[model samples]
Target: MIQLIECPRDAMQGLPEFIDTAIKAAYINQLIEVGFHTIDFGSFVSPKAIPQMRDTAEVLEMLDLHKAKSKLLAIVANVRGAEDALRFEEIDYLGFPLSVSETFQQRNTNASIAQALETVETIQNLCQTKGKEQVVYLSMGFGNPYGDPFSPDLVAEFVQKLDELEVKTISLSDTIGVATPELITEIFQVQITSFPHITFGAHLHSRVEDINEKVLAGLKGGCRRFDGALKGFGGCPMAKDELIGNMATEVMIETFKEEGYSLDLNQMELEEAIKLSNSIFL
Candidate 1:
């Protein structure tokens, strides 16, 4: 059975317009009914930077988790963002995204790789103190567009830094959709062997054809807890050429279904989710 994670909120990042907060909160309840064990809902960042996520706080307040079978994820770019997220009761998971490529890190978050990890350390400590789960999103874990050479050793070293922070979950992000199946195997081999207890997963940006290859490698590497967006909505605009950022949940379901795996998603419930997503950004 595949434990497919859905990411509706993250999927809308690249959307050009900001939907009404009330409408957003209204749709979130629909997604909660589906069987996705987790949903990366929204991020706490500057409105000017990622306008699509500007309503995060209000959306969290409006979210109805009366049937909270699925965990909630809130992306935080830095210590202050994580600090702001801690003030909310509706959020269940705190995600920290750090790009392995230095140039991309500076472009995306205005922080170098080292500075980002320092922020992660601070955020991780705060999450532990505030009783929140910390997740590391290793952006460009597969490859980067900034001419940085990708390698398993570099990724392993980054994961080692994440381990030191004691984060419970980690995601290898294919930031620019450059990861091939062979590299996926190499990178996964190192991290999974080193951190057996950590719940690691993939946060991909590649097309449908590429997903299976990477997912297969992830499975072979003993990874669990992958993430995907609904209807392929979101991607980081800062990426070169505005690349699509997340793996779509609908596509994810189709792939997992072929293998007879399930995250227990109700087909009718998912259609409702799609409607909710369309109503917001389409």
Candidate 2:
């Protein structure tokens, strides 16, 4: 079965306005019933860095997890954040963005590539002890605008390093929405073939028009996991001033259905969540 990860946190984080905690929770609570494999709900990062998500803990508290079929995932930038997320038994996964580009690594997490890898190792150990899983996002996995060295081999090397650390899932992230369909196919094909044990996912950012093509390319290259946000609402604030939105979840659902994939999602609940997103995002 294809794993569809709904990323509400990604949709909300880049917004300049602070969404009320109650509203955030309400929107996410609606998503919880949508039957996504996982919901990327919130982050445990520093409030100063992402003020919009300052109330992540509060949001979690409001969720009706008793009825939730979707697993909860939270983003954490450092060990402190990981520790904070681990405190919540409700969170099933801790996600970290480990950029392949040295420049983006520092920009995104204020750490070098080596430092970030070390952090990943530490976080992995922490997750293992806490009985939670860690998802490492290979940010700038396609290519960066910063003149950094990029190649399919470079991505494979990073995947190799993460594999050594026993990271079970790695999502190749297109931080700047610059990846071509060709690049997506190449990288996913290489990684999926090379690392059979590790689950490779696509966290692609793209123009609205390019969403179907990019997602199709990843599927063609053997990617079964994908990350998407409702209505393509948000992007990495640290990447650039003009954020490129995430792959739209609704559009992705259409594509996946057309491709004859049956997703375990409630159409009624998903429609409700989409309506809720319009209210929260606007």
Candidate 3:
């Protein structure tokens, strides 16, 4: 069965509406009860850059992880962010984003892709020292707005770069939500075949209509772990203007449930989660 990694925290990064930690915790607890195998809980980056994630630690304290068998992941931008994230035992995956877009690397975190990769060694060392697993989010593996077209060959090369760095899993992210089904299949297939040993996953961004096609694309390409937001929560304010949100979890569930696939997430529990989200963000 394919595993779903719910990412409400990462998705809600630049939300215009601010849902307090308590409300977020309440909403998240509902998700936890429903049962996703993993979750990208929050980022430990500088609050000045993403004010929404400033409550990372507090949210960790508030979430009810014991309700289900799931891993909680957190995005860490640098060594410092990793350090802060390590202090919390609640986090199971330490996501280190490596952008294929050089311009995006600097604009998002004020560091080049090379510089970000440089920090990976240190971050990996820290994760090992602290006994935590690390995940590499391959952001902008799709087309970049800078007129630099993304290619499967380049994607394979970056996966090789990750292999050389001794990174574990590689998460392909459609940072700008510009990915088509054909593009998704081609990219994942090439990388999965070349890096057969590496754990393959996706962090997708698509409208409600694209859910099944995108999911099937990755599944056909041999991807087992997929990411989604509670209520279509994210779009990088730094990546582009007027972007759609992250792939919505409910939409994915509806598609899969009808197809007789499983997520371990129940329909009633899902409705409660969306209701909470609507109340808080709608």
Candidate 4:
């Protein structure tokens, strides 16, 4: 069975206007009923970096956790953010973006690659103490536009280092939608083959036309964990050049259905959530 991680936080963080905390909670509460494996709901980072998510804590407090079967995941950029997120016992996963490209590592997290590794160590230790699982997102995992010498070998080295740190869940992120189907298959095949114990996920930003090819490539390469946004509304605003749209959750679900996988999502609640999304976005 595949694990679907619905990324509302990513969809919202790049928006220009702040989504009211009540609206965020209501939408997320409805999403919980749809029974996703996990919900990437919010972030605990500098408000200046992602102003739309400034009220994440307030939204979390308002969620009806008693009705939620989905695990909560929050994005964190540094040790302080991770520490802040850990204060909430309701959060099950703390996701940190560790960019393979030095340029994006500094842009997204304000740290170089080496410094971010140190930060990851600190955050991992803290999560262990707080009983929260740490999820490291290998941002710019496919390729970077900054001319930062990218190849499948570079990705392997980064994953190996993360594995040495004992990070169990690593999501390979195509931050700029630069990944080709062949590239997706090759790297995922290598990583899953190398690290049998780790959970690998594909977080791809894509043009609508590339969705099927990319998603199928990841599946062909043995990835079962995937991340998606409700309507492909958001991407890394901090990425170089033009920002790309996220993979649409509808497409992912449809693709999986065609593959004969039963996700067991509540169709009625999902419809409600989609309507709720229309209200929150824009």
Q: Largest TM-score belongs to which candidate?
A: 2
Question: lDDT of each structure?
Answer: 0.80, 0.93, 0.83, 0.91
RMSD of 3: 1.5
Measured over all alpha carbons after superposition, the RMSD of each candidate to the real structure, in angstroms, is 1.7, 0.7, 1.5, 0.9
Better of 1 and 4 by lDDT: 4
In model 3, state the lDDT of residue 274.
79
Model 1 agreement with the true structure over 84-138: per-residue lDDT tens digits: 9999866778988888888888888899998998999898888888888988888
Q: Could you give me the TM-score of model 2 versus the true structure?
A: 0.99
267, model 2: CA deviation in Å?
A: 0.6
RMSD of 4: 0.9
* Candidate 1: residue pairs that collide: 11-234, 235-245
The per-prediction tally of clashing pairs is 2, 0, 1, 0
Segments in model 2 whose C-alpha atoms lie over 4 Å from true places: none
Q: What is the TM-score of each candidate against the true structure?
A: 0.94, 0.99, 0.95, 0.98
lDDT of 3 by residue, 9-118 (tens): 76778886666888777777887877888877789999888888888888889887765677889998999999999998778889988888888888887898889988
Q: Which digits, one per residue and each the tens of the lDDT, describe model 2 over residues 92-208? A: 999999998999888889999999999999999999998999999999999998999999999999999999999999999998899999999989999999999999999999989
Give the poorly placed runs of model 3, Cα more than 4 Å off.
Answer: none
lDDT of 4 at 236: 89
Evaluated with lDDT, which candidate comes out highest?
2
